[model samples]
Target chain A: MSHVGYGCLMAVDREHVLRSAAALLTRRATATMDEVAKAAGISRATLHRQFAGRDALVRALEELGIQECEAALGAARLDDGTAREAVRRLVGEFESAAGLLGFLYTENQLFEGEEQNAGWSRIDARIAALFRRGQESGEFRIDLTPAWLTEALYGLFASGAWAVSEGRVAAKDFQYMIVELLLGGALRREES
Target chain B: MSHVGYGCLMAVDREHVLRSAAALLTRRATATMDEVAKAAGISRATLHRQFAGRDALVRALEELGIQECEAALGAARLDDGTAREAVRRLVGEFESAAGLLGFLYTENQLFEGEEQNAGWSRIDARIAALFRRGQESGEFRIDLTPAWLTEALYGLFASGAWAVSEGRVAAKDFQYMIVELLLGGALRREES
Candidate 1:
């Protein structure tokens, strides 16, 4: 294989390891570096070489999350569809990343008043802008602000994911639960 | 007061102590027993006397959560009002117990196959019945199930509470944010 192709393959492998570690750590936030390494199928030495320590590894995971989110936004094609449809596609995209989002959601709370990672804010802005565009185009309701809607979406997604994991709700219903609640409101609409 | 009154007061105090500890531990799950005692302003001995250990404490909290949820269901008067109004009241009651709810929201995941406390099922039944009532009355849309709506409400409440706590969203807007998003949705209304 060409050098560039080999490098790309290596980067993909690294990301796979990092994401596995992230999934494990998210469920068990206090997991040791050794356990994370084991979960990723990498030796301790290699894990240390890849990430200097736990904090460095988490930072890398955060970057990975940001990249995935950007990719989801692109894939959802927010610009092409109605805001409501866009949100549905976005929620579906976000379903896979729910665990990481849950971790970051709590982690941000631990250090109140500290600056949030800039990547998160950037992603938030992009999501918020989508909602704003929907409102402007008369596709969404005007009562709630784009900011609160964005936060609510994040919270509901985390809650729905956790609920499904706990068997309190069905796993297959995650997308339907979030989208229906967000778009249709829980109240029964009057039939014409 | 009479001896019986004094006994009643002591029982109330015990309940208070347990709740304060649960609130503290919900935010800091790994906090030591001493920390929990200090948080409740009770002696370590008293705390231990009430709850034999961390496991005991969590179990008590789980029971307390179940009871509180039942109380909320009663207080919300789910049968008397329209499902929309009932949900609004339900969300209002839940807002006050947001911390405990958030804690249970995560804790329930740990007991994978164990039977959940029966109180949750009862509460779910009440909420779901209200939604069904609304549907029959031509007040709610038929597409979404009452079960999903119930779960969605729980998710949105947790998310809204966390957002308010982190200062990402305002406390004053809690009710408005949740109700609007859950009821009216993000789509702009025709009249708006």
Candidate 2:
């Protein structure tokens, strides 16, 4: 029991450190390790012990993004309602991580010439599965493939993040805009 | 006159060199200036004369992208047809430069902390104007702003380029996927 408690404490500390690191990196992608340590109110030595370098920190950020995405998916209950509603729920839940994910999405150097972390594949699969479910249920059009839709989701996520960062898109509307555009598109649906 | 003939020759050569540079850089954004000169079959001196360094080369590429976008916009005839049809034509014409445009879109270093090229404003206003036309004609839903639509177009262009590069999305489907997704969305339209 004592060992389990100790393990829990370490995990909690590690998560706190990662969260602080992510917050700093999201604001300034080029921030150095020393700055990260400063922002987290920890010693540079401790930061080094946790993440040895910039690349390692980015990898940790990528891991954090994946964990949060999984958590959001779990909370979204994407299987509970109409696929459209489920998408709305997913987008709503996913909005909090938009900044972090946007950073990871555009940080191409970390991904180039390397096989992406398997966590992303799992996340993509889940999202694509949701799109497939919509298609199977006749809610989504069948012409666009699930893979394409999944890719488009990431693209929109990055674009929406870009818009918000540029002060062009309001943060509160990120979820509404992304979900509406992805699901309903820009055309006026003629009501009967 | 001989002067006019010489100027014309210089213009053609410069455009040719820029086109080759664009093709190479689109394939490899990290390609060096020496490699660009080599690929363009021009001497380093000539390449340097034309572009003093990578920054200048990139600026030239940006100019090329702007010029091509203008040409595509001209060919698209954004003013002549129904907004929907106009968007389709615009996307079709824009497809040829997707690779080069995608390069410029993601090259954040070239644009960060710098005032964006004025050419983009002209291009964006034109595209946004097209969307506004759609909204006024009741051809598009109004909840989504024309600015957002224009921003989304750039996002989709980058995404479509990315998909085609990864072989996940076929080249033939590039225009179809982008146009259909941007206009019609993913929902199955109810044929009333």
Candidate 3:
């Protein structure tokens, strides 16, 4: 009981730090570790006690991103409702983490040659499965493969994040813009 | 006439080298300068005479990317027909240069903190205008802003290019996938 209690306490602090860092870096990818520590509402000495530098912080953020994605997937209940609805829910749940995901997408060059974290593959597989379900259900078009749709989701998330950060698009509209563009496209649809 | 001929000849060689470098780097971002020289079918000495190193090579490529984008825009004739047809034509015209655009998009970190080339602003504004044209004509959804659509086009292009490069999606399907998803989306529409 004592060990479990200690582990839970540590995780809460670590999670808070990761969330704070992600929110800052999502908008400003070049922010310093000191800024991250400040954003997390902790002293620099306390922050350094956990992570060494920006690189270490980013590595931790990657793990946090993966965990958050998994949590979103679980919370969305992807298989319970219609795939389209499922997709909408997933995007909404991801709204909080989109910034982190965007930062990771742009900074992927860091993992260019090195083997990327395996967690991404896991998250991708789950999302791909949802798209596949949509195709099987006849709710989606077949010409665009599930794989392509999955990749496009990542691209849109990055674009949406950047657009919001640049103030070109309202942050409030991020989920709507991406969901509408991904599921319905730019063309105005006639009432059926 | 002699001076014009000399300039034209130099321009042709320069264009050829940029295309070759863009093509090679698009597939393999980490390819060596020596490899780029071989891909361009030029000697290392000759390549160095033109550009000293990879940094100079990328700078030259930036100019080539801008020139190619401007050329595509001109050839696309964005105002010629229905905005939809114009967009389709613009994308098709950009096909040959997508690889170069993709390469530059990923390597954009190299330009961070520096003023980006003005040509990008020029290109972005033109593309945004096309979306604005479409919206004004009721051809597109007004909720999705012109700026967001333009950014989405760029995101789709990068996604399509990456999908093609990775063999996750077929190369031939690149343009169709991006255009269809951008224009019609993943929903199956009832034919009017």
The parts of candidate 3 lying over 4 Å away from their true place are A1-17, A20-58, B1-13, B24-57, B109-112
Q: What is the per-residue lDDT of model 1 for residues B28-92, given as tens digits with 9 covering 90 to 100? A: 65578898889888888988877888788888888888888888888988887677788789778
Clashes of each: 11, 0, 0
- Point out where model 1 deviates above 4 Å: A1-12, A25-35, A43-49, A52-54, A111-114, A166-173, A190-192, B1-12, B43-45
Q: Per-residue lDDT for A98-157 in model 1, tens only?
A: 878877676555545567789888888989999899888887877788888888888887
Best by TM-score: 2
True contacts kept of 2: 0.63
* Candidate that beats the other on DockQ, 1 or 2, i.e. the better one: 2
lDDT of 3 by residue, B1-192 (tens): 457455644533877888889888887777888899899999888888889888899988888988989999999999999898989988888888887887787676445568778888999999999999999999998988889999888888877787787678898888888888888888877765
TM-score leaderboard ranking = 2, 1, 3
Assign candidate 2 its CAPRI class.
Answer: medium
lDDT per residue (tens digit) for residues B39-151 in model 2: 88888898898788888888888998999999999999999878999999999999989888878876752355779999989999999999999999999999998888888
- Report RMSD (Å) for each prediction in the order shown: 4.3, 3.8, 4.4
The lDDT-based order of candidates, best leading, equals 3, 2, 1
Write down the TM-score for model 2: 0.87
Off by over 4 Å in 2: A1-49, B1-13, B41-46
